[model samples]
Structures are given as structure tokens and as C-alpha cells.
Target chain A: MNKPKPDLSVRIGGLVMQNPVMTASGTFGYGPEFARLMDLNRLGAIVVKGISLKPTQGNPTPRLVEVPGGLLNAIGLQNPGFDGFVRDYLPFLRHYRAPVIVNIWGHTINEYASIAERFNDLPGVHGLELNISCPNIKHGGIAFGTDPKMARRVITAVRARTRLPLITKLSPNVTVIAEFARIAEACGSDAVSLINSFPAMAIDIEARRPILANITGGLTGPAIHTIALKMVWETARAVKIPVIGMGGITSAREALAFIIAGASAVAVGTANFSEPLSTLAVIKGIEAYLVRHRLPSIRALVGTLETGAVIPKPRGPGRPCA
Target chain B: MLIENTIILSHRLLKGGYRLLTLKSKRIAPMVRPGQFVHLRLPSPADAVLRRPFSVFRAQAGRLAILYKTVGKGTQAMATLCAGDEINILGPLGQGFPNVRKDTLPLLVAGGYGMAALYLVAQRAPVKGIVFVGGAGADDILCADDFRRLDWDVRVATEDGSAGKKGLVTRILDAWLNKELHGRQPEFFACGPNGLLKAICKRVGRGGWDGWISMDRHMGCGLGACLACVQKVCKRDAAGRETWAWARVCTEGPVFACRDIVWD
Candidate 1:
């Protein structure tokens, strides 16, 4: 008698993931750091910490300060720049079992294209994750993410440089996320990951001042999981390409919700900080959910939105669906 | 060695701003030495990214324990953890102390929470060694009973005079070295605030003495990439090519020889 194997395969853009779970950029730090703690091979894909055209010193001390139910960091995209990342990080990443997606950030549209062009032919780099939303820096950090026109221009510029699959990371601090997702899609972005950090702050009551040196920080944790899911659903519906949903996923159930909401795959960010094995747990959870539901593959759940699905009415004072 | 497994055995309060957390990981425990640490992901989600590094206070029988002071939200959340919980822990990382020689008289020195990093060495050192511990006050002094149980000479000096000697631990070390410690060759193992370690290094000098110190720095990607935790060293290559590169405190060392380290 043959035992059933778990259906854990997932595809995003042109890359195939053994599982839908991946480590979010910045959180996993280039993949080698966690090697001593866990197996890098078990992960579906490792999205390395954000890289830029040039080295970044990041922000000053008190760069990270903890807040309620989460943390706030103004690390300011501190990386070794493109040359160092390619020379140093990419070589080691090739040894890992999973695909390595290098997350790139830049100060200008051409800078993004330049970095993309540089990495277009490198070995071991499976895809490019455009980190268009970074709140910790001063320059083009959050510029492209917050404005649709800039986002399109940045995405278009990079698209013109390489054939590598592009995944544009979206920022949550926008008024219309669906509009931005549509623009990114039209600009030739292969997939979109939503949403990046929600700009938030925490104050030190005793000091009567903000805890972080940079008064504001990006919020992430279970506190913003729902918000991320909503954005992912909206973006997935707005664009024809895949959506890599991530925000506050700490377990398999939460990951499944993203899949049901139309995310082609999911990224586990803050949950990694809480539990290093969280990505593995999410992958296991997705497999278990698929097996129990009698689904043949994960693709069945991707973009499974039922048009005209009933909207639950609020239990309080009375508003019926139109 | 790779992390074979990880389990949070227990998390309990010890005193003000301090906690005793036990992590059971066979992989980390087997390879860990005194003065090394593990970088733990603080259960915070991605956007609030970054892992916090904690020194390995004690390791035995496939288990590692850390004594951490709750300074912020990351540690506060760590404090709330209970038995059977698990956090992502990457370690047995950084350089640990050189193996204690049988003939040398080992001297273990620490300050405040710094005691946490030195406790294991004190317990493991040969019976002939002396353990000199210091802290802000009596509350800051830790693991005295454990060291005493090992039959090592355990001395305590507190700033507020609420414990052993009525002065700073360095003063006690100075007095002991000049008086009772005369003519003996003691290899020192120390870990504490940079200023305190600097003062100790200055007094001890580099002649006829061998010692190791563990340094601390803000780190990102505990491996090497971010270059957030770089430290200077004193030595240079044969061609005077500065053999002292910017060593990563996370991977290259959390511990280094006293003569090799360049303290600011």
C-alpha cells in the first residue's frame, strides 16, 4: 500500500517552490546567519536582506526598539551594496537547496535597473525581489512604494534591464494599494508581494519621548496580519500575476488564509523572529490542509475567489448586503 | 555544528530586570564553549525585523541557558515565554575561550549581567582556579552558589557594598593581585562592559599574563554580511599588512585574547 505524499509544490512567476512558504527579506538576513540554528535547505526560498546599489550605514544607534506586540526598527537598509552582495553573499547562497531571491533596493530608477542588470546573469540568483518600500531611509526608500507613478517608473526601468522574474514588494502605507498593484503589473512586474511595513511609532512614557531614534518605525506582527491579508486580497484581485502575501503569518492556518484569499505563495516575515521554524510550520500546515481537503495541488487554492460570494453581515445594528 | 533541535524548557523571573531562560538544543550544546552566544529571533514579525544576540550563560547535557535582562519589547516578550515554547536560535556561534590548561591558575572575572557569560567557565575550570565576580550590588551578583558548589574560591565585590568587598570588583582584583595573588601565574577570563574590560586590561597589561575577553556590538545577520558587529584587533601580518582585520563579533568572535583585542 502506498502512503500519500504531501502536496507542497507552489509556483510564483517562473520559479517553482517546493513549498509555498519563504522567508521575507531583511528578516532572514541573506540565509547563512540561520544556518547554525536550522536547515536552510528546508525553506522553499530565502529572500535575502535588502541590497542596494551602494553600501548603507543604515541609521544610528537605538536603531531597534521594541513596542507593544512587535518591534520597530530604523535599520535603514544597511547592506554591503551590490558589489559586495554579489561577490560575497551570492556564492554562499548557491549551496542552499532552495532558490535564492535577492531583494534589491535603490536610490533612483536607473540605480534599480543597474543593480538588476548586474545580477541578471549571476548564478544561484533565482529571482529578484524589488524592495520598493523601506521606511527607515531618507532618499528613494519609500518614494517608489508610496506613489503609483514612481512605482511604475521604477518597475518599468528594471523590467527593461533583465529577463529575471521580478517581484515588487508593496508598502502598506498607501491610500490605494490595488491601484499600485495594477500599475506594477502593467509595468511588467512578474509578481507582487504585499504589504511591507506599516509606518508606526512607540513612545517611552518615562523619557516622555519616542523609543526609536527615528521617531517612526515600520509596524509588523500579529497586530497587522489582518491588514496585510486584506491588502494581499485586494492586490491579487487587481493584478493578473501572482501575489506573494506576507505580513503577520505565524502559523499554517494564517498561511492558508492567504492562499484562499488568492496569494500564489506566502512569505513569513516577523514570524521568523518569533519562531525560526515558523516557515517550516507554514509549509507543513499548507500540506496538511491540502491533504485533508482532498486537493491535488496548491494551485487549486490560488486565485480561488468565488465571484458573488456572500458577504457576511455585521452582527450589530443592521446593514444588509446590497 | 548545525542546530539539531531547539525547545524552550522554561522562562522564569530571577530578579529585577532579569530572567532565566533554558533552551534545549543538542546541536548548540555539543559545540558551545564559554563566552560564545546564540542569536535568537525575537518572535516579532518581519517588518519589525532583526535578531537579538544572547550570550550562552551555561550549557550542559544538551541544554543551553541564558540569563537576560528585560530591556525592551523583544526581551519582554521573551520573558513571557513558558516551558515547551520554542524560538529560532542560531548558535554555538563566535569564538569561545581557549581551553583551560591544567597547570595554570584560572581567574574568572565579570560585571553585572556579564557574570552570566563567565559562570560556565568558572564551573568548568580546574579546582585550583579562583573566581572573582563583581556587580552593581548584591542583586547583580549571580550564580555564587553554583560556583561555590564546585569548590572554587568565589569572591564578590559590589558597588553598593551590599555583598562581598565594599568596592568595585577591579579594586578587589588589584588588592588581591598585590597581596594574596603574589608570585602566582593566573590566566584570566573576563567579560563585561567595554569600559570595565578596558580598565581591567590597562591594569593587567600584556606581559606574563594570558587572558580572554568577550565583546558586544549591535549585530545584523549574525553571520557576516551587514558588518554591523565589527571590532578592531592589534596584530598585523609579517609584511605589516595589519593581520587584524575587522573581525565579526558574531562569527569571528564574541571572545578574543586580551593582547589581540583593540579596545577603544
Candidate 2:
């Protein structure tokens, strides 16, 4: 008899996926942008770009710039409104076997609730990845993802308005990310996705001007991997709900790091830009790792980090390290 | 429209840092339309930069070539690539130049290495026409002989007075419009810097003739996912109202109609 295949299935609240690798919102346009390049059915889930109630024109030219190990972008949530997305992208997404998680964002609590209510009625939407951590936008994004109170209110408002599973995408700009994770759980969030691009900026020395038209953008890529891994571990420890870890995930090793760090699932972000097939590579790599380790399922690998020999506490708090 | 690992047949560096890279591909080369580009991932110590896009300079039976100048860290690293190296490429992408119209005479315009993008157009055109090639100096002007070999009338202009006409290309184009054309309508096919494209668009609009210009933008994900390369374009609504919208340069076009573009 053939050896049994390793199970890669994972679940986050009501959303069930074939695998644990998902496309980070915005990195994977609705469904068709990358459909021609790779098989969409293989993804754990597909998170389309962020969408709002009304169509947005977005920011001006020069929306992106590259640094040593990351890319900064200030796209300002340019998207086809709900109506446009439903008319143009939904039917296409429904054709795929992968679960469709529509990433939704709004400038106000009311806007968030309103769009949430609207999407709640949509049949094809599997979940809502609430984008409160987008740093490039002028309002609503980092403002809600960073502030504990606003985060709670928006999550609560959206939770009440929509019955779909809510995955709050958190910001890394705050001092304590775990506190926000607790708030997301307290406010009825089903799961939490951590570290949406750290707020960042780059400058042109010769021109002495900001590289992006929006002045500052969000940093995403290998540069933020370690930082995001730590945050995912912290948030995972602080909450009972599944943690979806992301930020600069380029390979299977990195995705496995998130799972071992306690993320129930992982999303491929900037790496999608580098390699359109990065998600597939990550999915394949994760399976190989599981088979090598003899894990029963991906769920068995979640939060399995072995911190061998914990360091003794530093002798009291000394003079604040300068 | 497809991703393939193409083998480098040749990597040659010409003077002025311009490099011509030839790759052998069964899928990309033979299928590429004129003005389309390939998203090339050059090997580096760290994969920091996103894939770089280069318009197909020449494409034919299982082989394609890209002519690029070393201007950034990506291209600088790409220079180290040798023949027989395998590079990952997503290619033959974006809407390319449409076929020449039967009723109008074809006019080719290029700036500097922009001639690389228009070579296929000249070769594919049913009838030969005037080609306006301009640059800052003699060294900057490229590929005039290729057009001449194909029997297209090539006009060279250098701003520094180091080659051909001692002024901008507009000086020579104005002279042609004043005497050369015996009233045959001209449809322009241009690929160049924004300034040259704008100038061509202006003349085309003024003359009420058909024109297409290939656009160059700072791109990420040469796929449409990144939203990095966006160009504001005119969109027509149900009521026939002209409004503005952002079009992804990597997907919708590296080529667009002269009249449809809003310069601002």
C-alpha cells in the first residue's frame, strides 16, 4: 500500500483551508491577476486586496520604493468599490476551490460596520481580513490597528455587523502588540493576523526628497521577518484564537518559523512580488518539513517552538540602558 | 504571460554601459508581440530588488533579446550573468503595439535606446516609413543602421550637435511636416522617455492622426498584483463620461494610445 499523505489542512474559526499558506491581501490582487501564473486552488486561502464601500483613486505617482531587504509602498488602498468588485471579480473568485477572504478596510467605525454588513450577505466571501494596519493610508488603517480602544470598537462594530469570521490584521507600530491581540480577542475577533508592514520611509539623497509620493510607506520583506516572527510569538501567547502570521514571508522556512512561533497559518506578502509562485513553494516546503518531522498534521506543528535552556533573568532592572 | 526559465545564449556589453542579453526560450520568444516586455529576475547576493522589466528588443524562433543600460543595482548585478546561465523570467507580457493600419503611413519615433523597443514594429510594418531617432549626442544615438537595413528612412538628431541635425528631433520633424509629406495621413509608433512621448502625443493630437506610445514606469511585481506601476488614464463610464482612473502599467499596458493618456 502507498504511504499515507501528510495532512496539511488548517482551520481558523469558520474558515477551513486545504493548506496553511495564504496570499496576503494586496499582494495577491483579487483572483485573476495571478491566476494565469499559478494554480489558485493550491493556496490555503486567497485574500484579495483591501476593498472599501466606494471606489478610490488612491495616491499619486511614485507609490513604491525599494530598500536593502524590503519594499515600501503607499498605494493608499486604491480599489474598485464593493459594487465593482462584486461585478468584476467575485464571479471569477467563486470559480476557484480556494476559500476567498475579502480584506476590508474603512476610514471610520461606521464605514467599517457598513461594509462589513454588506459583505456579510455576500455568499462567496469566506471571511473578512480586517485591514487596520496599513501604514500608508492617511486615515483609518494604522489608526485603528494601533489604538487599543479604536481597535476594540472597530472590531466589535464589525463583529456585530458581520457573522463572517473576523481576522484583525494588526499593526507593528504600537509599543505592545500583544495588548492589541488581547483586545482583538476580547472584542470577538475570531483570529488575528499580525505585523502589517512597519511604518517606514526612504529618501533620495541627491534630490533630498522622499522616494514615495506619499512621503512614508509600509516596509515589507526579509528585513522585517525576524521582527514579525517575534511579534507573532508574542501575540500567539497572548490570545486563544488562531494567529495568522505574516510580514516578509518569502520561503517555507520562514512560514514554518511563523507556525512554530504559534501562527496557525501564514500569508506570503512581499515575496509574491519577487516570485509569483512563492506561495506554492512555501506550501510545498511546509509539507516536506512535516513529513521530515513525522508530524500528524499541520495543527501539531503550531506553537511547537522549543526554547531550549531559558536564560536566567537579568539581575533586577539596572540604570536604563542608554 | 508565461513564466519560464530561459537560458542565456549571449551576454555582451557594448560601449556606454548598454548590454544586450539574448535568451533561448521555447515559449516566450516566438510568442512575443512587438513592444511587450519580459520580467527578468537577475541573480544577486540578496534578492532585494523585484524583477526588472525589459522590452523584447528582438524575438524570433526560440530566441529573444533585451537591450538595457546598467542604471541601478539590479542591472549592475545582472551584468555578471554569463552565457548558458539560466534566469527566471515572466515574459511576453503587457499589451503591445497594434498592427499598422492599412490606410495610414507608419511613422517610427525613438529616443536613445528606446530604439530597442521599436525595432520589431519597423520590421513588422507592411510599408516602410520615416524613423525619427534622437539622442543627446552621437554616443547616445543607437540602432539607426538596423532601421536603415530594413529600408526605413532613418533620421538622426542630436541635441549637442554631435550627430546629424544640430538640434532636437522636433526641429527635423517640423521640417518634414513643412515639406516632406504630400498629405498622406501618418500613424505614429513611438517608444521613448516621457518627454519624447509627450511631444509625439502633442503632435499627433494636433494633427488628428492615430498614435501609440509605449510607457515606462517604476514597477514592482511586473505582474499586476503590486499596484506599483500605475498610470492615470481616461476611463469611459456607462453614460459616456470621461473620468480618470489608475491603470496598472504591467498588465493593461506598457503601450497606450496617445490620446487616451492624461499627462498630469
Candidate 3:
């Protein structure tokens, strides 16, 4: 029997990726580190580490703390600034076949605009993944992501300056995530990636203090998979643009849940840290799932949420249906 | 540059909480040198979300060994690995020891689990050399037989006097230096706890000895880009500017010249 050629290609914004499997920002540092472990060319796209207008020292020691099912990291925004990124790291990324998405962070609104404009003209640059959801730093990291209005302002400023596709990464810390999704779409963001790490804390009972140097850090991995799914569902339904979902997608089955919830593509974050070849595992899992279900392409799975699918209501006094 | 072979040799208990896992990969072995390490994927699919880094304890033919103490779910899952089980393994990564001359009197020092890294150096070192080991007690001591079989002069020190000498390994080292048994100044190599390495560095002082020490730090990419595994080093480039540069232990080295390291 002839095995079916898996159709994993996906399109987001103006870019057409060979597959929906992309490395999450921060988790994958420019994609070269894992090149020895797996073929970089096999990936759909590579999201580089977060870049800033100026060099950042990031957080102090004990920056990472391990929890029950995830990890908390307060690694500030450590980078060599935009100039260094373009001059030093850009050339290395050009060697790979996959599109390179530069994850950018800034201290102020103007900083985002200026850096976006600079990256807009760089060769081999695919798009900009605006990291507006970083929670480790004292300023501007989570500031834009927490407030819908401020989120709109930052995305708007960057969108006006660059022709490059804009991917606004949303933080799950906010109460009304759907509202934030609407605000980002209205402000001209080409697409949106939902649910950056959740803010969390871990304590060392023996030491009688927090495990991380920053006292608190952003939690990521399987522990928050459900939360990420819910946020992606709400945000994807609220916006017309594509939503790239990520949380604790360790296998193909988990990633399919995000696609069903309305995500166009999925990013593998903390899972990459656990396995050097996790991206490939996810790709293989998705392919196996497609073959098992006899689906022709991954597109057939996206936004396939069944209306009749059971929706479990919160366990409390029932209110009248809207 | 390629994966020649990969196999799970054995997974067994080391101490009460740790497990020693031996994996065989020839592609990595051919390129591996002392002080380099490989990143192993933990078996847990959810709870542990990062590939744990283990020092290259011993690499030969197509096999490499790693001694890890299971302090969490990730390592505990690693302990469950059985022979023939396929696990993801990345190369004999990071810069290793500078190829020493045949005549260099290599002196190897290890403390506790630090022996995981020093074991390889002892095996590969010149036929005539000495190895000093330190552990909390006899139970914590590892690979004493391996070193003994190699015909290298093996010195053991346990904190509780359950082994060879009573007191810290550094004290044993001081005695060796004062006695000057070998008649020639030895080139020292050490990897262990930070506290032990710090004490050794202080005793040796600047311009006193020629040696290299391996450092351990939290790593993100295991590559140089993340800057998460930065260690202070006194480096001099082409321009002769003696500056403090952040070196990644995963890439630049898990092994560095003793004089180049900035002890804090």
C-alpha cells in the first residue's frame, strides 16, 4: 500500500510555511543550537530569540525555577540589541531553508516602531513576531500585553512602520483575552499568536524562599495546556485573522486540539526544551494523526470545531442562556 | 556531524535518588573529547519540559555514559529507560580539553558526581598520571574501580573517613603538592562542586599552577546564543584587549584554563 504524502503546509499572514510546526520564541534561540540534533530545513519556520532596541542584561541568577509540570523563567530580555542581531545573527539564519521570524521586544512604543522599521528591510527576514507578552522584566514586557488599549497602540505603531507581516503574541494573564484579540485585529495586526507563558511562582520550603531569582516568573509547559487551549479558542473565534496556538503541545494529539479550537498553526514551546527533536516528533505525530483519520491536508482540521460538540458549563447555579 | 549509532546500554541506581544511564552513539563518540556533554530527552512527555544536559562521563567505540542523580520527575523518567529503548541524543557537544602533550604530568581531581566528567580524562590521560577523588562517604564514591584498573595512581578522600583518607579532597591535594612525590610539577584538571573548585582555585592562586577547571551553569539553548550559561573569563583576543567575556559552558567549554576563569 502506498503511504500518503502528508500535507502539513500552512499559510499565515503573507507568508506560506511548509508546515504548521514552528519553534516558539525564547524557547528556540535562533534555531542553530538544535541543528546538530535535527535538520533545520525540515521545520516550517524558525522563530529567533527576542530582540530589543538596545542590549539587555536580562534577570539575575536562579532565573529559572522548575515546578510540578512546567518551568518558571525570568530571563529579562537578554539580547545584543537590534543592530547586533541584524549584523551578527541574521547571516547565520540565512543558511537555513525555513523562514526566520524575528521576535522583537521594546521598552517603549517608539522603540517597537523603530526596531520594526529597521528589521523590515533586512534580507532573509520573513516577518516580525512582536513579543508583547514577556512577564519577566520590570517595564514594557507585560505592559502592552496586559492592557487591550496599550496592546493596540504597540501593534498599531509597528504595523504602520513596516510592510512585514506582524504577529502580535498575546499573554494569558489578562481577564478579557477575547477583547484583546479584537483590539489587535482592529489595529491591523496580520495575525495573532495566543497565550504566552502565565505568570507564576514556585517556593523552596527548605530554603524558605522563592526558587527563582526574580521571586516570580512566567510559567510554561503542560501545566498550562488547558488554559492556553481556552484562550486560543476564545481569541480565534473573536478575530478574523489567523491564530497560532502554543502552550504544552508535546505530541500531535495535543496540537490537533488547538487546531480544532480555531488555531491556524501551532508553536512548540517548552516541549523543545525537553526534547532536542521534539519539533520533528510533533510533525510526525500530526502526520500520523492525519493518516489515521484519512484527512487529506492539515487545512481540513483547522477551525473544524463541531457546533454540536459538548460544552461543559462551570459547576455553579445555572443562568439563563444568552 | 552525523548520528552513527545510538543504543541504551544500562539504567541502574547510583545513590538512593540518582541513576546512572549508559548510552552508545558512535557518531558522537568519534567526535567527543573530555569535558564535553550530550543532551538527553527525559521520558516524561508532560511533567518535565526540557532536555536534561549530562556530562560525557566515558565515550568509547560507539558508546557514551552519563551519571545523573534523579532529583525530579525528568531524571526519574530517565531511570526507567531500558536497554534497546530509543531516546533522543544530541552530539558530543561543547569544546573539550586541549590535546595535552604525552609528557604532561596530568593530575585529575573530582568531587562527588563531578567524577562523571573526570573519569574520561583519567582513562585518556598519559599512561603515567594520578587521580584524586573526593566524596561525602564511601557510598557516594563512584568509579574507584575503573580508575584503579587503569593503573593510574588513585587517591580517595571521604568526609566521614569511610574511604581512603579522612578530610576534604583539597586537603589531600595540599599534602600531595607539599610532598612533591612526582619530582615534576603536574598539570591539574578538575570538575566537581563549585565550592570545591573555588577552594582549589584559592589554594593555587594566580601564576602558581597550570591547570583547567570545568564549570556548571544553567543553559537554555546549550548553544552560545542564549547567553544563559555565561561564566566570567579573562580573555585576550587579537587586539590584545584583556576583557571579561561571557563564555557559554555548553559551547565554548565545560573545560577552561584555570588562569582564564574568574573565580567569584
Best by lDDT: 2
Model 1: per-residue Cα lDDT over B36-62, one tens digit each:
888887655443456778998889998
How far is A113's C-alpha from truth in model 2 (Å)?
0.3
DockQ for all candidate structures vs. native: 0.27, 0.75, 0.42
Higher-ranked by DockQ: 1 or 3? 3
Residue by residue across B37-155, what tens digits does model 3's lDDT show? 87765556446655667888788887778887766666767777798887777667688776555866777888987877877787777656788899889876788778888888888
lDDT of candidate 1 at residue A88, scale 0 to 100: 74
> What lDDT does each candidate get?
0.79, 0.89, 0.80
What residue runs in model 2 are displaced by over 4 Å at the alpha carbon? A309-322, B237-239
Docking class for model 2 is medium
Clashing pairs in 2: none
Candidate 3 local accuracy as lDDT? 0.80
User: Which digits, one per residue and each the tens of the lDDT, describe model 2 over residues A205-230?
Assistant: 99999999999998899999999999
Fnat for candidate 2 (0 to 1): 0.70
* Worst window of 10 by summed lDDT in candidate 3 chain B: B219-228
Candidate 2, residue B160: Cα displacement in angstroms equals 1.5
